[model samples]
Target chain A: MSEVILELDAVVKKFDDNEVLKGISLQLHRHEVVCLIGASGSGKSTLLRCVNLLETIDQGTITLFGQSLNDPRIDPDQVRRHTGMVFQSFNLFPHLSVLENVLVGPVRALKRKRSDVVDEAMHLLERIGLSDRAKEFPERLSGGQQQRVAIARSLAMKPALLLLDEVTSALDPSLVGEVLDLLRDLATSGTTMLIATHEMNFARDVAHQVAYLDGGVLVEQGAPDQLFTNPQHDSTRLFLERVR
Target chain B: MSNITDESVSEERPSFFVPRRKQLLVGRRGIVASTLSVVIFLGGLVAVFYLAPGGAAVRRFYFDRHDMWEAFVGNHNAGLSSVGIGIFTNIWVFLVSEVFILIFGLTIAWTRMSKSPVLLPFRILATIYSDIFRGIPVLLVFFLVGFGLPPLGIAVVSYQSVAVYGCVALTLTYSAYVAEVFRAGIYSVPHGQLLAARSLGLTNATTMRRVILPQAVRTVIPPLLNDFISLQKDTALLSLLGVIEAVNAGTIYQDTKFNSSGLVVASLLFLAMTVPLTRFTDGLIARDRKRRLASS
Candidate 1:
């Protein structure tokens, strides 16, 4: 069996009176791509945020690399260093150039040598086909370009797990294909990623396991073909029906 | 060239040509009307200045009668050898106070925004200082710091000149206002920028200094310049402390010579200094706005 890379047990998160995540449990094994498919405000984003320790859980526990992330003693910053997250808005630092955005994680936070880090960042930018635009700021790039750079920035950290929060939602329809293609490439290359997306086809095609979330509840989860072709839960079936 | 009918040509050209022709016509009419009104207003102002109570003689004396001119334009006593030296003193004080205000004001603003529980007291103190200093008139601060602090037998404050006391007073007063301006700038930065920085594992301090502050300072430049202009004008209030800055020198000349032209000259000089700064700030804001529009 593949060793578990991340585990969440009955994790609950609340914002004021709103209970966003209710007793959510999931496990991600090494080199596994898990896609969380849900409607808007269904707590998919909140769950991913919790895994990254961006949002504090009110109950239960989250363990990353077998260390309890819920424990107050464990620094969130350290956890984030290992777990990369790409947002829906593609929140690249607008002030920094494209190359600097990719370089900052290793150079600034990890205290890596700039000369060593810049080479790696340049390689990442090159792989993403953005080497020529390295000097350009985020605002100067198209939406697809910015999103791709954000993904590259996240990957620059060499994270154990990458969490994508509906990364293609803000992208134009034409732009979505390039980002998805990038994500697919990452998935095939055995990168462990947990994605929250509305794209059913993307989940079915790229995900090893497809989990459906409804109103903070994990409805059902299985291999993508099984879940898409033969959903066990009515909620999952209904969701797939509506999305198709 | 193959099918150049009059109707087709008219159809193609009217969309571009009609608007251009109409705008040209309207612009010509507007310029004529505006120029005529301005000429009429100036003529009326000239007639009033010469014909009204106190007439041309009063205007000439305060503006620049030959006798009053000497008192304003020539050598003067009360520590101002000439009007140039007096204006120079004011400019010197302004530069000194401005440098200190930006540094200390941003520091105080950061203190107000400190999230650490350990800094609760300091935050409270900063907030109180800003509120009280902003409430009290700057002139009162000049009076208190210039006159009040020295008489308590404090050696350090008592030793400085009246000009030094005035600089200290202005710095203390304006730093409070500038701190709030800095705070507003800090707040104006989008929350997403900080979130993105923190999510990248950057410490709060690093995120603030690198990501938040640079953007915030850029966004707040116009407002900061506005506060700076106010600070420039407030330097005149140092006259209350008997500093021989332009306003004080002007007042001394007015008192000894019994002519108001000295004060008028000082006013003109101040306008000459501040108007350019105001225009520069407006140009900066326009460029910033245009850049934003282009990027968006």
Candidate 2:
């Protein structure tokens, strides 16, 4: 039995009058890849933000490793340390070098020794094959290269779970392959991931489980093969048909 | 087929003669007209300087090269030449108050931007300080801090020199203006940058210092330099506090020599300093524009 790393039960979030995520319930287990798929404004990105505590949930609860996140006693920063999120826009610090961006998490947040973190930062950059561009700023990099650095930055924190929100949607179609290949490799290496993405083919190939969301509701969730091909809900079926 | 394609391509070419000739004629006429206007204006001014009935007086008071020299370097009782000491006084007050304004303005800006409930009172105080100081004329602030403080017979302030009083007044007034500049710069940073930093587990203060401020400060440099240029000129206002800076020195020479050449010399000195700084700021703005265009 795999340990549930993250679980949401009836989590609801609203912005002013708009209910972005309504009574959403989902779970992610250790070493598992879960993909959330839906049309624009369907609460896919909002759900990931709520889990990371970027957006506060208006009701229900989020639990990580059996700890309730709704408690005010829990610091959002502390929660974020255990869960890393990569943005759709590849939000690398433009002023900092690639290596410094990676090292900011470990050295500034975690209070690790600079010398120790420098080696780890270089090792992470090496893994992404961006070791040569370590000293270059984000503005100098291509979108694909920058997204890879963003992932390396998150991975440097040694997060227990990673959340990717539309990571490849902003990239050119040609550049998308490199980042998707990187994610495929990360999955094979057993990194736990929760992704909100529009890449149905990528989700079909890489996701252990796929969940369909429609207008702030989770319509259906199951193994990728079952959900993608044999969706039990009409909404999921309509969504799959449209995307295909 | 090749000859037919060539004929079609040649037929599609637009004529370049009529509009090109019109543009050339307009550009040449504009150049000649501006050149003639500049020459006529400059010649008229020179004719007035040399041929008017009061030309001799004008030369003696405002254009006498020797009087200008004497007014700039004429020694006062303090042993240093008037112009020498005047430049020194202006530089000293400008540099000191500049340092204070940078620190005080950025602190006040941060205070106003703070969101914590515990800091609400401080935020209101910062807002009031900026509003009141920026609203009042800087000359009034000089009089108040310079003259008003000493007569109250307060211990440390009462014993301070007139120059120190002027420095304090300028710092207070300009810090208010600069604080608003900094606040605008800080807010100009994209909200997404803050989101990205906070999502990485960095605290609010850490995010501001590391992510936001560096970018904000870069964007504000041109405007900050403009403020400093104004501050450099405002050092003359210190003369009202009996600080004996450039304008005061010029006034002394005008009174003693019964000529305005000293005043003209002082004006020229200020122009000399300000013009280069103005050009430098323009160059910086042009370069920044080019960089933005390239990146976009």
TM-score to true structure, per model? 0.90, 0.88
lDDT of 2 by residue, B59-147 (tens): 88787898788878876563324764587788889899999999999999999999889999999999999999999999999999998
Give lDDT for model 2: 0.89
Lowest lDDT sum, 10 consecutive residues, model 2 chain B, at B287-296
Error of 1 at B120 (Å): 1.2
Q: Write the per-residue lDDT of candidate 1 for residues A74-131, one digit (tens) a residue.
A: 9888988888999999888877789999998888889899899888999999888889
True contacts kept of 2: 0.63
Off by over 4 Å in 1: B1-55, B65-81, B282-296
Clashing pairs in 1: none
Q: How close is candidate 1 to the true structure, as a TM-score?
A: 0.90
* C-alpha lDDT (0 to 100) for residue B5 of candidate 2: 55
The top-ranked prediction according to lDDT is 2
